[model samples]
Target: MRTFWGLMRAYWFSDRWREAWTLTIVIAVLTTLLSKAGVWLALMIGELTYSINFYHDAANTSPLRTTLTSGVLVIVLFVLKDAVIAGTRSLVSATLHRKWRGWLNSQFNEALLDGNHTHFHAQHGSADSGAAAPDNIDQRIQESIKGMTGGAIGLAMGLLGVATSLYFVGENLLQTSVEVKGLEFLGSYGSSVLALLAVATYVPINTWIAVRLGKAMERLNVRLQQAEGSYRSELTTFLRRSFHVAASRAEDVQKTMHNRLYGDIDRTWARLIVVTVGYNAFEAVHNFLGYRIIAYAPGLVSFIHNKLDLKGYVTGAEMINQLIGQCSWLIHVMPDIATLRANSQRVTELANAIENVQQPQEFYSQSGRSDFHYASQNPVFGLTIQKLELAHQGEDATPFLSAANLRFRRGEWTFLRGESGCGKTSLIKAINGLWPYGRGTIVFPDGVKSFYAAQEVKLPQVSLKQLVCLPGSEQDYGDAQVASALHKAGLGDFIEHMADESREGKIWDQMLSGGQKQKLVVARIVLQQPGLLFLDEATGALDPDGKIAFHQAIKDNCPDVTVISIMHEAVAPRSASGDEFYHSVVAIADGVATKKPLVPNLPRELTTILTQPRPVEDKWMRFSRRLKQK
Candidate 1:
């Protein structure tokens, strides 16, 4: 509840606050005026009928002018109030609906940004594959917000009006009954009975049913969301990989997605049927007795005793009419109010999941190499490798990376090597500040900017030029500059052909061969030009020839750039060219890293030179001293 309030307060205090409140007040005033006009009009007509009946029976006192005038006045008031109410509701609904939609969308986008959309996916699972489905969160928020907010606010106002009217109407009925007879009804005891019955009967049962329904809806929502995701995946494949899906005969995939959606809806409909039927039965039987039969009972008994005429009975019925109408509104509003409460609770939970939950302790930026730090303001220790950890289900230790410590200074490449499941990717993510599950520090130059290219790339709907430019960037690049970079990465031909075509959903990540995609990833590295580059399987997709060419391109293009690559191959070839090429190779195995010999296999000449130690003249051996200085 507190979480929901925090989210709601952000909007309630926004610039739209005055407008929303004003609309709310206008709608409330109009609804109240119409309801009172309806009751008064009914009473006025009853008075006119009683006056005519008296004139006919007594045959002396004529009240034709008074009766006609009162009847006309009541009708005019009714028409005017009803017209204003209609206009007010239409205007308020139009403005409020749009405002609600815009607010919800903005909130959702902000939540995504603040929460780190990438982090949420990494922790919860992919947006497509997570146990808690995010696919339909947007849809659910959109469809539910307007109805929930408007209905909830309206019901609240209606409830307030009902309470106020009940108090005053009970007082008026008591005074009228005292004037007409000795019977003492419509007093403290009567009002208490009615209020007690409302609370005891409607509140608890309706609340329980509403909560249960919300849980069912939430489950159904998850299934429907999964089905939608599956359908979208198939659709994307059909559009981009038409030949592949067709050749593979993926009709079964399409059919299965459709069947799942239908099945979910079918089950939901059955549950809804039961819920609606129960609600209808309760509303009908309760309103029939409370509003119609019981309300008129007092007036009917008075008429039989001759203590009240038809006029008095009609006037009493008018007061009863107000109470009955209000009660009917309450009955109709119960289920929706419950649903709104449930939805509000969900919104709170989502807000808490993103914002309030404490994260694992991370390494402070101060404890890193002063010269090699990446955008931190202070310095403490060089190679500040702090505690490394990962979060799993419910506080159990699932160590993606454990007490790992390895650091390299400027002017060297430290290759992290590990067998499968050694947390290579996890290590890179931790260094990049994407993995908060681990607690550790990776000290580097304070102002250095780092760019990472993961194994799987995300390609947005944009031109090849804009794709390299990065999303939301305004830095424009000319065709010549883009072409040059593409040519260096062996994609110049593809760019020229695709320049004029829309590349939206072109499957750049999936359609391109593994090598081509790797080249593109490297091309982005060149284009973005970060000082420190962390490549996780950045070269896995590249062939040997492509890998060598791309590596050389990076060395030639960005000599001052520091690169820490994860490699499985021997470091001898990379180091053999010069001391600058490979001075350091840190091998990470079984969740630990150590400076070790480069793996076996080098070109025969280089191998012979490295194998046969020549005094202390070896460049790599001499360079070890240089590393120790930093």
Candidate 2:
């Protein structure tokens, strides 16, 4: 109950509180009206039955006309009630649920993206699971929220109708005393609410039985939801990488995995089905007993015993049946209530994760960690690291990069070369303040922007301009400037697709080859040129000629940007004018990075282009492949 309330109560406190409260109150009022309508409906139904029975006789034809009139009246009123109910439900979904769910989703969106998207994942075994969104978060945001919200409304409205049922329908049943069999003691003393008491006891007793037997319903519901989410998540992953899977001929493997996952859902459903059938069987007996209690009442028994008016017996029995049905509402919706609880538990988990994201506590901390950085006297636009150490959180404190001091300056193309899985990216992450595992001082240039690119970029399903100026906006850049950047990144062939901003970009991410994708990222970099660039093999997909073009493109567009590249191979590149392409290399061996200088010149001019009449045909040919040479 607290979990349900925890999710529901937050909406009224949000910025949309006025609208939220207003819609809720409106719905409540409408629900009350619907309840009143239900009471009137039961009263009219009894009257309809009473009038038909009263006028019916073998000699007179008035019985047929009366039956026709009463049946038509009842059906018309029932239809109108149903129509109003439909409208009310639509209003509730459109206004109340939509706004509240949207508000809740926005809060989660903010929290999940809190740590610069470090808090967001697909329930994958990456980062801290405590901070990430729970399993099947999309469904939680869509289906679970709907289940909770709509279920709450249904329960509330149903209860209201039941309360009205007691007021109107129970009025007659309570006034009459029992005169049938052993139940005579019920009203022998005084006029008593035999119907109300019977309803209260009978419904709950059966409900208790149903609950005890079907206790596994909540657990089964939760298992089913998560299992379905797992299957959908895997299916999406398979589709995204279908080309590789097909090439590797792993279709059979994927099919087997999918079957196993689906089997889990089927098993959970099987358990749920048994519980449900048993519940309904118990409910059927409970409801039949309901009819017996009201039918045998003295009010109806006297009507028949005295040969009194048929209206009395007819109306009394009708109202009494309605009263019992209303009282037994809980048993009827028991399965829905169980599902609501399961969904509530999951939604609450998501809410807890979002809460943790907003105020993240430290995972790991060491003494004097913040005091590592100090001001440097280096006259360059780059970073300085002193005694830097690296390690993962929740692991042993033996640092990977132990007490290594290194400095990189502007006008220098430095390579961080290391063996595969040797913590090159970890050092880069430390420099950028992402990896808080190890300690050291990382001194940075003030008021300078930095950009970090990894081996893979997940291009969003968006337009061309949006993809290029991602994490930014298309309106932020000019058309000519974007076109120039595209041409510069060797994606001139893709320029024609940018004409329609509304066109989907999802296909491009899949259709583009690795080299083409790398070129697109270069286009992104050229669009938003940063002062310091960190490339963790961002150009791994590009060819040798493309790599040379990439360096030249960066030098041309981002003149002052300090490029720190982590490479596998060692290549001391020299220009036509005897200028070094890379100023130095930071070789990582024996768990420390030692700077190895390859250039004597402090700031070599990197403007040696094909326009300067380079004698080497290879250099000239590579430059010709670039847009500027064209």
Candidate 3:
């Protein structure tokens, strides 16, 4: 309960709280007005019916005209009431929906992307073993925000309407009386007391049922979201890697997707059915008891019979009794309230996850590097790693990199080389502040811009120009400069295609090959002109000559940029003639790193002469020669 209210308070007191509160108040006011108008309309109809049945003959012609006038007035009031209700609801709901979605998206992005906290992507996991980490964060930001905001607004408006109904209906019932066997059973105040008792009894039971169903719903919703996300992720992967899957003839992808949908989704749906069935069964009983209460009560039946005997055919007491029944709106809104609670819990859970990911101390601490801090005010240029030690995530005792110290100076190109799984990528992550399971201090120059090109490139579904100028706008670079960069990266063919104007807004992913995609990523780096560039097998798909060309292009385009590359033996520079390409090489073996100058190559004759063993003289001949000389 505290958590539920906490979520509401956070949203209602947020930066846009004023707008949210204003909309809420307007909706509430509109709902109250509509409810009152509805009750008035109902009363006017009842009065007309009473007059037509009981007083039609005694009334003068003027009374009939008055009734006709009242009917016309009621029609106008009804139309106006509905119009205002619909208008206010539409305006408030649409505004709130948009506001909530924007706020949630900002919060999620800040938590995940800001401050180099991308490690959260690797660390996040669900408590339930059956479920995976919350990968459908985009879905959550869209669906959960919409569901929570709409549910909360609807629940609030429904409660307001119910309150208004009760006030007018209860007041009307209190002004009338019913009698049984010449004895008055329920006067105005007595009927009010009985209604209050009925409400008191109904609220607790309704709340209990709602609470139970809400808890079950929250759990099932989490699982359902996980299952749905997993299924969708699989489908997306299959689509993205369709060519690879076909070439490799891998059947497991299909089988895994099947299991995710049939196995995980089926289990969640089955549980949902059980909870829904139980809730509905109890709801039916609760409704049955509420309607039967007036009939089964000791004095109520006699009261109704006596009212039936009076006024010839229709009775005023019967009308009042029916009006009092409008109080059931309070009971009927329980399901909506429960839905609101469940959705609020889901949104709260996601917010908490973001909060947890932002706080690194909850998982690990960087104790050795406590004294080291990046000073944004007086940032240094280049990269520095001091006393760095990183352990694999969730394994404190087993170190991945131990006590490694390295440095890459400004405007220098350093190659990071190691066998697979030897922590080269981990070192890059540590340097970039993405991996927090390490004790390290990585110092970067003040106001230094850095770009990391990963092994697998991710291109946005935007135009070719926008894709190249990403993290900035196309307006930041001239079309000529963009074309030049693309030409240098071997994507000159795309320039004409991009210049066609018709293809300006088209997605270019499907049109580009694997090598072309890598080249495009290089083009982005050239356009970004970062002071520091980290490449993790960024040109893995490109041929040797293509790799060399792209590396040369970086140096050519951005002369002073520091390049730190993770490369295999095939891609690392092989000849002393190309030694200018790299300043040094840092090799990782086991859990240790060693730095060496980039020798590139030695002459084959020198290598053979140095590596081959010298011939040895016989020990006896050497001893005899030494004695003779002495």
Which candidate has the highest TM-score of all?
2
Provide the TM-score for each candidate, comma-separated: 0.70, 0.83, 0.81
The C-alpha lDDT values of all candidates are 0.57, 0.68, 0.65
lDDT winner: 2
Residue 414 C-alpha lDDT in model 3: 80
TM match of model 1 to true structure: 0.70
lDDT per residue as tens, model 2, 531-621: 7788888878876677777777777788778878975444533444555567677777778677766645532222332112124576556
lDDT of 1 at 310: 83
Each model's RMSD to truth, in Å? Answer: 8.4, 7.6, 6.8
Question: Per-residue lDDT for 301-323 in model 3, tens only?
Answer: 44467553223112333333333
lDDT of 2 at 514: 83
The candidates, ranked best first by lDDT, are 2, 3, 1
Full candidate order by TM-score, most accurate first: 2, 3, 1
lDDT at position 219, candidate 1: 51
